[model samples]
Target chain A: MKEEKNIHTNSEVLVKVEGLSKKFCKDLKTSLWYGVKDLTANVFGNKNVRQLRDKEFWAVKDINFELRRGECLGLIGHNGAGKSTLLKILNGLINPDEGKVTIRGRVGALIELGAGFNPILSGRENIYNNGAVLGFSKKEIDEKVEAIIDFSEIREFIDMPVQNYSSGMKVRLGFAVAAQMEPDVLIIDEVLAVGDIGFAMKSFNAISQILKTSAVIFVSHSMPFISRICDNIILMDKGKMLLKTNDVGFGVQSYFDNQKLLGALNFGEENIILNNVKIHSENPRLEGIIEYGKKSIFEINIDSLNDYPKVKVSILVYNMAQINVALFESRYISIKSIKGQKFIFDFGDSFLSISNYFITVRFDDLDNKKALVVSNYVNYRSFQVTGAERLVFAPLYLKEKI
Target chain B: MPLETRIYQKENHLKLGHLFKASFKDMLSSRFLAKQLAVRDIKAQYRQSFFGILWAFITPMFTALVWVFLSRSGTVTLTETGAPYPVFAFTGTLIWSIITESINAPTASTKSAKGIMSKINFPKEALVLSGVYKLLFNTCIKTLLLLFFVFFYGVGFHVSQLFFPLAILMAILFGTTIGLFLTPIGMLYNDVGKIISVGLSFLMYVTPVVYVIPKEGLMKTIMELNPLTPLILTSRDLILGNPPAFLNYFLILFAVSALLFSVALVFYRISIPILVERSNA
Candidate 1:
């Protein structure tokens, strides 16, 4: 019987979603009672009827993805990108209107910290409640209870109501419950951003340890975290998956760049979306590593604009090599601020040591703080000094360095 | 992929027995919360009134008193056989009112419990089911009051009246069916309450709650179509020792209950996904 059913199932892959769609119903439908009156021609026009006139909200459309075992897939998206909804569907919290989410393993999700937890209940009470909600039996909860409590480090207050607990405590308990649940598949939905930095580090460490045994799906805005943790990144926007990438910085930059590329902005002629950014201005032969005290100038040419836009321009240079550096100050003078305007500043023998540097261009007037044009990356232009670099921001320069 | 699709089918089409058991467990665990909510509903209904829950008894008593006055004035005849006219009207109205409240419950509870659903990932049916639970509690209270009157007013019960609960079940079954079908529509439609309001009360009177039975064919057809008629009559039969059509009420109630539950499960499954997705997580 199972084989017969499988034969009927179109097995393209394990999980095949051809064209997923979701529509949201409004809270107070205008077709409410007011519509009845209006349809009967009692009033001029029914506000309720007008509101109910046409309220069909589509949240997700044509969403498609496939996941296999041992894949640490990262979902990077902006707010309301439907990542959490997708996760919730995967976790069996709710059923989608027009989509299919297929999974083989016992999927586990930390979609939000303490998603079903009750504030009035004590931590101990919540453990059982939450565990039960997650589909664990009472006996299973009893067995994992000790490890969960110990990991959360809320033993002292475990018996106290969660309303009395701090935010950190909530996340801790939530994380501990998930960690101890030992699911085959784990999903983290930006909840890791909570808690202290140290605790975050500890949580990620625990996550990494768990990754050895399970597949992980993570949603985050932290690019570096995605880069370091996930094997591949899937970028989503609105309800669509825009790009899938293996490179960390490139993927992060692409996500930001895609927004500008695909945003509902009417691009005038002479306006460029800045498709590809590269800084390859070869100078007096800098070697593999630019050492300390070697004078270097970063020459950068930004390629953008369909047609040269008429506007003045300035570039903000940044040192991105994890070196102690000040905020970048805009120090370029461009007569034209229009599109396709390129301006470069030669930091001739600047007081900066060997490090990777980038420059970003932002266009805006002072009035409304509106940033008309912004690039995720400055320029790929990087320079290094060709000598021994001991001190950072060097020019602890000794006069008589024999 | 098809198997996966089957597995991902919406709103867990749990077997009926399993669903009932799970809901039962949830209600049991949440009994304290249910009590708290029912108390709030009951108290809120009569808040700041001198006669509070006594009002539950008061409404039926006044209705009966009006009937008495009408009879004394020779305005109308109650046409009672086994009991006094006032006692007859009082018992029927009291039972029917509670049952009607039960039918109207799922709608009201769905509207009121939006606060809970929006904030928590609870079983949404809890709100709907709790309404029936509250009605059950209310029904018990009303039944006890009726029993007191039956004894005090010297109305006797036959040995066959042991099946009063079976009659109550018919009422509940019909009530739950109607409640389940309308609650989600109520959640979706803003004016559902008003529609149910004027419509259901008219339905109550037509179902033979407060008057003598008319023997016209049209009246019988209307009575047959009322859905609550069998419930009221069967319950009256159990009390008054009429040859109760127990099997007929059982089949009708059972079939209607199944239909309502199935419809409710479908609506719940369809809406729950959208509800969660649209929530401000």
Candidate 2:
């Protein structure tokens, strides 16, 4: 056999997003004027582009990645890591503030379930509209209409208006349209967590069928799904990337590592003012911080930002719905003295049996009720927890036969 | 651990023109979507009601009566063929209802469908266009009621009255223009939708829809300046053949439509992507 050449072709990459960032801002002058002067400035100087301020909060910041033709790229990161921002850029639903993204074919992004569907219209009508949105023609949508309905398993209500359908049915129908249309690139956010287990299973299997030719950029906290299908993983945090790799297991572990680190470091205020913070976990995902039913460690470091302080640097456990479930305020619980700007909080010995949770740390200057209970003046990191926690935020005790 | 180094990469968007065209193309191809939207629009009001579609025309009919009673003292002056004041009032009311529905169509037609813009991949214009089809349905039914007045009320009309279609077309053109002009701005500025609706309501009386033609200088000029005024007066003129001096405003509205629509298109195209990426609060 002839020696192989080491050249990579353009066709190899289905997508190239370089320095992709998107920023949304308010017109400061208009915001300031609040009257006619601001209106004039908005109309005349809006396009000046130079007079624009950098007070921008970048939703997706400096994101760079490429997806090959058939690989599923898992975008795993804690909340606010800009995963949704990156997915929007790749899907062409929106543009970025500062990067270039190139894709070879039709891209279907289900950023959220039921996003492009008209609820007042019938399920059948929405399917056609969604198909068109996914880049299919009327004939094409027509051809796939039956298949789409069958896949969603909602044929009985196909003629009924979507507004009347339940949430799960809506998601199922939405996913079916996105899948049946056969887009070159498919971007799915955390919607897989929605629907019942059977439906989730159905969605994953359907997604698998599409993965044969489609280059997928899936942003989900579900490690099993990532490991099962993603050819590579892109781990991100706080609007930046943590790592990228084909080793799915390693990626999952890394996700947990930072998660644990962030939660442990930032979950609670070690002091009145929080400063230097971090989180880590043995599972690489550091998932133990938030996900239920997993044993994990949380490490926190704190410093005083503004001094009149009595605070706790500890872990605050929140369920996925953002409800605070429990908290380990380490400062009042443990530390007796302060030496410098650093304090650490350990979750002691606990395997968070809950399936899903997030870590949030605050330095409250007051009590739990409102009179001036300031959660310090800073926000910390969060991570995920995994293992035997087979569901979302379900705290349970497992029996092992080993 | 230190913060993960987020390497900056530039995201590339296809040219604005290309995306805009693509979005519009996406909207145009979905006949089924448009039909369904039109049906839904018409059905939403009358859905599950025992009166069914009759309520669509009845509500407007009663509203016209209240306005007529409030405006006139039962004068039989509206009689084109000795028809009663109520019949003449109904004619103006029917036309006004159609125009109101059409103008209101643009504002709500697309605005209500914001859910789809963020979730699906389809061009958003289909939603905007959906309103037009729905309004057209309402207009058709109301016009049928207008014809009912023509036949049963025994109103007299010259063949020149055929120009009413032209007048109605003009009303539609202006309504659609307003919709196209304001839809994007409404999305950008939270209050734009409310402002457009209110402004249109004020302009309705300024047009001859709710009142008679005014006599004077800048007031006439201002009255003439209102786009729908010309269409309304011209329809009455079709029955009488001496089109109002406001006829010049037709050309002006045509120009305004182009300008407003083009500006709307540009703004919509520019703001779309940014609007889509906002979190689902």
Task: Give lDDT tens digits, candidate 2, residues A108-127.
Answer: 67676655566667888777
DockQ of candidate model 2: 0.19
User: Which residue runs of candidate 1 sit more than 4 Å off their true CA positions?
Assistant: A1-63, A80-82, A88-100, A116-129, A138-180, A198-210, A259-402, B1-161, B210-225, B239-242, B245-250, B263-281
In terms of TM-score, which candidate is strongest? 2
B1-281, model 2: which lDDT tens digit per residue? 11111222222234545645655665567555666566655665676679988887888778767866764765533323223445556656666666667666755755566665555556556665677677677777766766676666566566867776767766776667666655545544657767766876777756666556556756567776765676666665564444445567766766776566545554455445544543232
Error of 1 at B30 (Å): 14
Estimate, for each residue in A1-402, the C-alpha lDDT of model 1 and write its tens digit: 113322322323333344455544454444343323332332121122112135645555556766544557788777777776666565655555565666654566666556556666678877775665455666778888998999888899998878889989998998877766554567777766658887788788888876655567888865557767777677888767777776555565555545443232222332334332232223434432334444333333444533323332333444432232423323423333344434443333344554444444343322244434433333322333344555555442222111
List TM-score (chain A only) for every prediction.
0.58, 0.59
Stretches > 4 Å off in candidate 2: A1-11, A25-55, A115-138, A154-167, A261-402, B1-27, B30-32, B71-88, B98-100, B156-163, B215-221, B239-248, B277-281
Cα lDDT for residue A173, model 2? Answer: 91
Docking quality category of candidate 1 according to DockQ thresholds: incorrect
Report iRMS values in order.
10.2, 8.4
lDDT of 1 at B179: 70
